[model samples]
Target: MKDEAFDPVRKLVAPGTTVIWRNTGSADHVVDSVQFHDTADQWQFRTQTLRSGDSVVYAFDQEGIYEYYCGLQGEEMCGVILVGDVSLSNSLPCE
Candidate 1:
């Protein structure tokens, strides 16, 4: 994830899968799990400000849609993770 974009922007994964975001930009950034209209209190998770080369990982243990964005950039830098029924083998469909 960067200042104004998330690579791939959207992802689909199995429950219990772990996702990672690596900061490659010069500025700081954050991964916030909340929609644009919701209050800060409604967010499920938020990462600390990540400087260049920093990385964050999260596990999706439930089936549903997870909306996330860079709190600093708001809607301009956002993404979604779609967690659905998948094999326990933990391999992504593309693999």
Candidate 2:
């Protein structure tokens, strides 16, 4: 998803796969980690601020549900990542 407020924020993909986060929004946004508070740590893990039209690719090596949000000066837009299995797990019911 490009916009931070993009609906249906959760997406499922296979494990060891590469996913792209495109900054189609008009403002600056960050695909930050929910764990570490340091921006450098985010950058170290390939999660960082993405300007308008820019994008970042992250490879979900592990299998689990990942929660993330926009680390910017705007609304608190959050999203979830379901890795490894395309089918809905108990944590995230199917729509």
Query: Which one wins on TM-score?
Result: 1
lDDT tens readout by residue for model 2, 57-94:
88888776665667674325766667774433333221
What TM-score goes with each of the models? Answer: 0.77, 0.67
> Cα miss at 71, model 1 (Å)?
0.7
Model 1, runs deviating above 4 Å:
36-43, 85-95
TM-score of model 1 vs. true structure? 0.77
How accurate locally is residue 61 in candidate 1, as Cα lDDT from 0 to 100? 84
Best by lDDT: 1
Which ten-residue region of model 1 has the weakest summed lDDT? 86-95
Model 1 residue 45 lDDT score: 87
